[model samples]
Target: MYSVARPCEVRWVNLSQVVGLSTLRSFLRMESHMSRCFAAILLVTTLVAVEVPAVPALPDAQVYAVGVIPDLRGMLQHTSQALGAAGKTLPPGMLEMGLGGMLGDPGLTKLGNGPILVAAGPGLLVPSWGAILPYADAEAVIAAVSGAGLLAEAAPGGVAIGSAPDGPGLAKRMLPALDAVRAGMPADSDLRVVVGLDRLSQAYLPMAIAAMQGAASAPGLPAEAAGQRKLMLGMVAMLRTFAAQAGALRCDLTVSASGWKIDAVQALRPGVLADAIRPQAPSTDRPAERLGAGDGPAVVQMHGCMPPRIYEAMATLLQETRRDPAAAALIDESMVAMVRDCAGALTGSFAMRQGFAGSPMRQLGVAMVRDQAKAKALLDGARNLFSMGVLADLMRGMGVEMVFEPAVRHAAGLPVDRISYRIDPAKLPPGQDAAMQAAMMPTQEMALAPTMWVWGSPSAEIDAALAGPRGAPRLAAEALGAGWDLYADLDMALQMKMQFALMAKQIPMFAGAFAEVPCGHPMRMAAALGEGRYRLVIEVPVEQVADFRNGFAGMQRGRHQPAEEPETPAAPVF
Candidate 1:
């Protein structure tokens, strides 16, 4: 989170009302019948006790099934055929969309008359529903999607788990939320509101890659052709499944006088959320034998199994993914000469420090001794037999996409988005305050601004330190390690969110309001984020106060209405 030097008092004055309401609502909801009426009286008294300011409701939203179709090309082709003669004249770029593709064909205006799914015009397709990561481009996407008012407006893009607290009893928080909007709803509202979630299998990625590999190695198929047909189909399946899950998925939304006020049950899409919860992967994949014999999930407790061989393999795999301008030239160099000059040094230079053992080294060595002979063998039986087709098939079974998009959205029984925080200022570890101070410190002299944001891509880097190595009972262990009876990162996000919620009180501006300007310079963005190991923080700019109010108001009411002003006839001026 970024820090700014704003008056703490200024922030507080803006937040009193929200805290008052939350506190009041908490105190008034009594379970026993005898105190029910008394609870109501307390509610009114509580409301009367503090400043009752109207704060805009933030967009606590999760639109379940916004499907993205795979292969925008397919979409384009379908769209093109629909557009008679103009299809032939279409520029290739017309088919490649960034945010939303701009099809030169006027007929393709509306995104298919069907459902919601995530797909790409090309290969950067996101799975059905998940989270969009990294803040720059991610922030832009979130701003646009939320701005379009899918379900709700956003309080800065912080990670949060919107689930009821777990224990031997009811989570005390939900009671207040239920009470806050329940009375304003109808009896049938229960049916309208439902909680729904979708999670992708962990194998989604590996299998996707396998499919692409299979296609690429197919007999008589061009590279693009193979990718276009086989891999594209797999992507479609992913989108279809994601959307299908979302379409059928039910989320508990409170039917409000405004619209659906969703109380999202926050969890994470499989790969991501589970990563923080489960044991972390060893930095280096060792031999299976290294892990030795142990119990629990498939992850190795034995330790020796995933020796440096896996890391060695991965380093070569990394090289395969790299495309240097000089690759073809280097490949054309006489194999023997190249090896003497290049082979020995390159392996030594790479990270991971592994010697030539993976495919690249093996291939390079083969090229050196008998270049044409090795080439003939690769082209003849050896390569064709366990062909690239074999690998593609493997990836298909694994659900891996050949083209990688760093971040995409998905739904996995958890929240694609979330918020958390710490309220009891004293509960913070001694050094934490210093960390928070550093995070909150402003990057520049725009110190006049009240908000500070560690405003770049917000993400969670889970280490085994949080979730003990493989099946260590993460949450409990983390709590113990942290010297607390209990603790969770999401819980921390929640606490911070609550603090913001509190600030949103007297400072109506704070309610679901946040602005994070990525460092004063984009180059410094990474440096800024790395400065504090911040969970989440968003500062509200006082100058743009009106826009914030209007945005929040729209969320609370489900739509924004232009403020009204008295009208005077223009006839007087005439």
Candidate 2:
């Protein structure tokens, strides 16, 4: 009778005990599931706020910064542990990836139930996000992630924001992978990660490495022992001679107010050009068959990289050397020795292409790039920017290859047929869109700019857009013409490649064919030659777009440096 009289007190004691045990369980469960932030707050809260119930976060638009997501299990594990420790409730359908069938070691069970918005790990800065980049660090990154999560809490009003960070160049590839995550996740998701200022060095070391691989080349060995020995000895000698040039160097990564950025998460396929370019004519080292345009346009962070003209010159040199025996002879033993030395330099150094020769098959790849002109131009230009040794250093700061060709090919398609591309090497970067009223010339009508090419976009939509009031022709009036350089929507280079390869079947022509290169389509050709030639610079398919605008603020400010801006949003609809 005494115990029954104290029913309310007994109930309170049981509830408190249950709450304590549950928290303990949550802590224990999520302990090893992450890089593990210190749960100091949770501990303090648990100790001091015993009677206070946890309040759910308000529903609001959210952005997510997804990172290093491997398996669904890991995802669940992270979510479970975080929520459990926080003692917060999870939104509905949060655990559906199926833990039973998922790999071993489930993460944490939900601490409670509540609504949440999801974002992925990787992300790119928006138009002006780069301004605050330097301020971001681990704590800042965590806040961005949390702030993004807040944005994701709202329903039916979300979209992912990112470009591929995981394409091509492996070591630093972030964009292609970011693109993949951006694509792979639900359309409503926004995956992002902006680490702290403290982490800037660690984050960008990989950035440099990814960029270097595409700009440099390695030596070729003649497969025979004699050939290998020749390359090795010459390489050793070269290293001894140039040893004085080797020293510690550091690069200051300036946070450009000019919006200087690169999504290096993907760089050029490392040494793919060195080992696979010209595989057909073993001795001539020219193409026997057109290597199927090896892959699609690899998303790369082209930081401090050369304009397309440099590559064009190198390609020409390589092609000339391949077809002409005299030119081949011109590449004397010394040059050959130099090539071997460059190849050798890869060893004990950061040149990613060095060890590739060790493979039996790779050794046979004496000439990865068949066009001697191209090779020479690239090598020559590379020589001036810095010696081979200095180049090795420069290469280190380049970028990473995120997603390889297969990954890019499998990712998605975007419709871009109706675009009027303006390849202005000297064009300026556009002024801030936000300040349009103030920035615009009072009399001139501002134009609509081009949108980014994403997975699932097609050119037909642009073509269809032309039939409307703001058609291609009207748009072209602004995006095209004399002063402006453009690749008139036709894929001429691709056609020429197809035409020559089918009719002549000549290896030289096949190798020279434009379609054989990555991003070979005329529509997306790299920077154009100053003037003239058959490069993909054309007027638009659209005839009239009063709203067409230029996106070149670089040109506006008279900044001569070429800038490649990715993930730009669609301009105002014409």
Candidate 3:
């Protein structure tokens, strides 16, 4: 539905090849009589000559995206050259021969861009010119489709029908609406399409919202749950606004073997988006401050944020919930107490920086200011909660130990304003020794090795208690197990090479294409909101346009393949 830039060329090429191969195989399987063979060959040739035409041109408003793909043959040539410059040879495969034959031999290249027009209607109408179906017989194909109930009438140019009419047909309806919308723009567009959100909203949004409202009013629902209905209504309102704005939306895509990019813009009208979302002046109540000193791979800092109105809204919700007797009864007392005790931890602004320098260290610094006295009290409460029988058992099983590293006093330092929690799996309780040892034992799928070991109490009292002549072993089994287990046996370099090999094997075009794309390929997205307009754009770099044919082959094969099960992530220790 959304007209974003995508890889389509290689797919179509591969599809045509698959169709050709299957037809050839069928011909070979028939009775080897000369008469039958001749007749079948003629039939197949006739069908091949009547290649499907490109999509028909529609009115400008009906089209969502217009793009041109650089000739794949040319792009592949460029890729081969680039790879040569990088001193890398492309993998040998059948895809290379397919690309060289279809696009042109990289050795004997031709240069030209192929245009693809996408119009919105009963289905996507793709008007391609001098692209895939270069030898198509337009008139005969159109006549065939009209006779086969695939089309009512053929539009101008080498266009094909996507499907039979489901209703009065999008073309018929869009033509009538053209005059009405013409006042705002031109009489016609270079490309015709009509599936814009504005058109859809005008045709169905009101009815959809009404139906949702009806569903929400089902019997036996409690009156106090009106919040749910209110939330749905709010979402509907936003959707309506977005649909209205989309009337003036326009998108354009430019695809190349080296890179692909798209630009889209939507006109905004006043009083459309909610007032709460309107840009507000910087909050003066919160003073500006840096999040932290940076030594980590990622850094995020937000300051002079959180407008007053947002807090007012939260307060209003809290008051309403407290007033509702049923809602108040469901609120947990411990949770409420926790919130009250920890509220001082959020002193307008806070900074948290986490990194691994030999070992992972997480530092959280809060601006408690006048509420500094409450930091210790909040931390002590947290320690008590985490140290409980139920919580300690769970934490120990997961090989995690939480310690409240009490705030250290310095010469004229604001230590009270900040509190820190240190996680040291090595300091787990003695009772968990056997469990830790068992967890570290190698499994069938993976192996673990200990790298660092620690023994003796981290605190003086415990160390003194075991200060006899012999004492315990220098490295405690539990700490050694936890530390050693952290050193996982993974060959990242070998894994990456294996993954590249697999992708290339599955998709032939990948050999030439993968050479041009840097690992993780660059992707960029941007958006902007203004007084009366909003716009968003996304860009992706594509390499070796000819390689897309493999994608098409995959799709054709997918039709007969069993659906694969979706992969799920491992369960969290918690």
Best by lDDT: 3
> What tens digits encode model 3's per-residue C-alpha lDDT throughout 458-549?
12211222222222111111121221110111122222322333333333333333233223222333333333333344444342222233
User: How big is the positional error of residue 58 in model 3, measured in Å on the Cα after superposition?
Assistant: 12
lDDT by candidate, in order shown: 0.23, 0.22, 0.31
**Given candidate 2, what's the lDDT at residue 128?**
10
Per-residue CA lDDT of model 1 for 1-574, tens digit only, reads 2222232322222122232222222321211111111111100000111111111121122222222222333445543333323113445435435434211223333333321121111112432222211122333344444454322111222211111111101111122232332233333323222222332223244455566445434565422233234333433333333332221122222222222222222232333112322111222221111111222111101111111222233233223322332222212222212213221211110000001111111000001112333322322221222123332232222221122121132222211221111122242322222233212211110000011000111221111111122322222112112211111111122223333443332233344432221111000000000111101111112212323333344334421222223222222110
Task: Tell me the TM-score of each prediction against the true structure.
Answer: 0.17, 0.18, 0.34
Q: Order the candidates by TM-score, highest first.
A: 3, 2, 1
Error of 1 at 399 (Å): 46
Residue-level error in angstroms, candidate 3, position 40: 64
What CA root-mean-square deviation does each model show from the true structure? 29.9, 29.9, 22.1
Better of 2 and 3 by TM-score: 3
lDDT score of model 2?
0.22
